[model samples]
Target: MGEPDVAANFFAKPQHLVKVNRRRRMNIWRSGQGSPTVVLAPGFMAVTADWARVQPALARTAQVVSYDHAGQGFSDPGPLPRSPARTAADLKAALVRDGIEPPYVLVGLSMGSFEVRHFAHQYPGEVVGMVLVDPSFDDMAKRLLKVTPSDQVWIESQFTHLKRCELAAKAGDLRPGTDAYAACVFQPQPDLTEALNKTYHDMSLQASYWRSLASEFSFAARDKADWPLADMPLIVLSAGDRERPPRPPEEVEAIQRVYADAHEQLAALSSRGARRVVPNSKHAIQWDRPQAVIDAVREVIAAVCGGPA
Candidate 1:
């Protein structure tokens, strides 16, 4: 059997550069030819290439496009002060710049979900529906702190470090995926070892950009007025396994509970949406469990493409 390669050539190519903001230029990847477009967003520390698992599945139904975010992969080093809203704004610009009209099905995974919600809120009219894979609500992180402030602070600090690593990776200066990220996600896929290793190595180099990015997180952390987009039609997928190593079983459970609550928060956002659990998957559900990602996306597309039903 052939190994899964999310970045495999599928007769698609990047056609143009969309200047999203002062410093962000989104590299748009495209495939298929149809209406009711679908735009994809990469996860934290991952470039658009991460969707290598599911993008082809989506291209069959609609115009599917994914891009590396600024300071992440294939994109220019974005301006400082990047947040959920700012990222969403960059997405809107990328879509427009690429000639992908509105009324799109925006699919985001993990960290990408945060930005997806912001995009739906910013351009509700343009978004027809959404698919949130292992979603993350802004307050989701805060839940961790509730248990023990120290734990939250530790995670916050870790997240800060990873974001820095991501920037370095984007600049082609270091590795991309971390060891933990690899052990949990990449190692499962033996076929993409070389590519995965490349991504992992690339992400490792982004520490150079951490200082400026740290400030952006503070601003992005600020809450938006209302979650108008949160209520948009969405399909949220959850991972079955939520284990963090070296931590006690109880500690792992606590993290799962936090993710569970976040999932509930995500489901609560939409009257027209539903949630599903992707079994035996990790944070990188799309890569670790590609079929689940495809299945969830199909469900969402069906709802959107379903005619008057």
Candidate 2:
């Protein structure tokens, strides 16, 4: 079959672009209607569509919103570095400009945990509950390094690869069938529609996309002090089936131990927090175990709404 018209397919769905500021506009997909809105925050380089399997189901119960970060998906590029604080501020501005009220049940995936946690910390009154899906904890790399120091080489190599992709995209040399493309761009996901996959591919070719990803990846590894989540309801979902990089079995076990401990610490941040180990799921728990995410969101919503959880 011939390639699809990605632009047409991508635009077929209604686009809601809210101006976060004069220089920045964010694209958001909102659905359902109820108080204590559920907001889905995507991981590093992930767009709103990544929550395709989970968002709709949660929307059935409470107002649900999924959005792309600045320089991602259909959103306009924002300031550089894309630190968690900056992303959190952009999200708050976008939500306000879009007229989505607070008292939210924030659902964060992977690196998104950083942004959502920062958002909650910044404006605790706005966030009533949180569901962290296979989250990245504060200073996770540093903590893990203490246990599995050998992974330093792997981490540096990954960063180098990201830089190369950024430069290639800037030079307009990251094309299909090229080594850079193979290394930088992921293959089409089987779960997404052909048109969506095409849109993802086209977006990957943009220099801004690579720049955003590289910036987020760099900041994500930096050490950040942990803070309390107060008594708000929180659920930390850890991926039981996380894939390990090439490493010795003992080293891998050590890393997993550190990971589990970190997640436990995250849950402990809240008085009402709890942690769960999701089986048969990889890092993208929403894709592998959407029901887990849906259930977690529902649970948080119920708690916030003073209903059974």
Candidate 3:
């Protein structure tokens, strides 16, 4: 575990800072104002900026917050082995420390879904709604291994390369292709500015971020368990378009089917839970189809804010 320390650095100019303990302080960004705050959690190796499109849109109608997980972006590194439970706890603590009281609408993207789901499970009264965008479900790794062996290899290889990059970053020698990796993950952003592009590149090179991602991936299966449905609105957004290299059409179709099935299973977490497919989107739905994410959040907000049931 990381030792408690003061948040002495402001190198990144974060909008809000909350000390979790003597050793860690979380950086938070906030916009707009209203009840039932919308908390946005970015995917693996991603920062709040990844929500560049959806967060602003959602903020217009409600208070929106997006923060860096410890060790990602401007946040300080936290304790090791960042399990979902610990991550969820950290988020709760940060919210409390900053006086951002519940009820909150937790919106998580990709790997972030695990943390938000755990948060709702642990603090049901605090979260009024949830929006899971292209979430990662339990047993995902094993399922992928069985259904698409080649795709599994590709996934593993990507992680392995990230691990190497982490090692290189630790040695003060960042590996090549940082910009390329950034481009690959954050592509199709015609609106990205030069400064934000540099920020993304810098974040991708952070060894701590990669380490956090690897830990999250390693513990995913171990964290699998039945999640009780909360009596709140829930929306699971799955991508209609799948990203893949040239492969057998049947294989691609099989993988897509499995993913869609998994997403539907997530919607079963609540009585009000529903699944929606974002047309022409890949895994990064916020980036691929920001309106889909915005709409889902708005729907949940409306339901929670007494607009409709």
Candidate 4:
């Protein structure tokens, strides 16, 4: 939100943006001058602006750059079957267009993790480090993404609740003069004025609209990453709590076991691999525990960048 308008002010001069003629501009939104460039890949149904709270802080430490994926956020429509391969290409092209010279610390969340994972595996030299915030591994995640008729109910419920929240915030029904706004802000979700809520909601709604594109590409073969090892300094932050419906004690145990296996496998692959849990957080661990994420990224940079931060 601020970056698009403030790009000129933040960098002391109007930042020039050029559309990517290649890839049909599938990747859009680029600006900023900084080193050790940080490319933030957002989770499913999220826009780059969703990172507003953390970008400024990250900008202070490094040149932080995040963009809306194709068919999501403010970006143009993307191709069908929004697989990891296509997303990775968009990220690569976007970075190149912005003149963000390589050696990036790719940070991805949720489905966006698929993009970063592919990016790292394909272009190892370009990536200096990796920060996966509750990333979904390709093989493991695909199983859950499989949509069934029942999945529609959960999806519809979330959509309705989010839209209502957006409307309430936009109408000023909740404001400083009202206890509603105060209480809403203190609630588990982000502090959104009705207007801000609507804006963010539009971003989410737009992203979800492209869910079909993801589906189209769902059954395609993976891009052949034998071992996504993540050889560089890596920080993997997984959701701390598995507190959702369908979670019987046994189910929870199974999830923990899978996560544990994933963590252990990464450790065996990289000496610098580190892992942490975003305490009491849900699937949107980044939003739920922003500070913990920032801290984890700092550690990754410290490990990879050298010197005492």
Model 2 lDDT, full chain set: 0.84
Candidate rank order under TM-score: 2, 3, 1, 4
Of candidates 4 and 2, the better by lDDT: 2
Q: Each model's number of backbone clashes?
A: 18, 0, 4, 4
lDDT of 1 by residue, 1-309 (tens): 242255443212333568776565777778777767788876655566777778777787668888866755556666656777777888888887777887788888767777877787777688878888886666644666665455656667766665655554455444335553432222333544555555534433454335334544554334342364444567788888754755666776777787787777677777876778878888778878888877766666667778421
Model 1 gets an lDDT of: 0.66
RMSD of 4: 7.8
Listing every candidate in turn, what is its Cα RMSD in Å to the true structure after a full C-alpha superposition? 5.3, 3.7, 6.3, 7.8
Candidate 2 backbone collisions, by pair: none
Candidate 2 error regions (>4 Å): 1-14, 185-194, 223-225
Q: Who is ahead in TM-score, 2 or 4? A: 2
Give a tens-digit lDDT track for model 2, residues 176-210.
88998898775787756777677778788888888
What residue pairs are clashing in model 3? 4-22, 4-23, 5-22, 5-23
Cα-based lDDT at residue 206, candidate 2: 80
Instruction: Give a tens-digit lDDT track for model 3, residues 142-203.
Output: 77667778766777777786677677667656545565354333332344555555555677
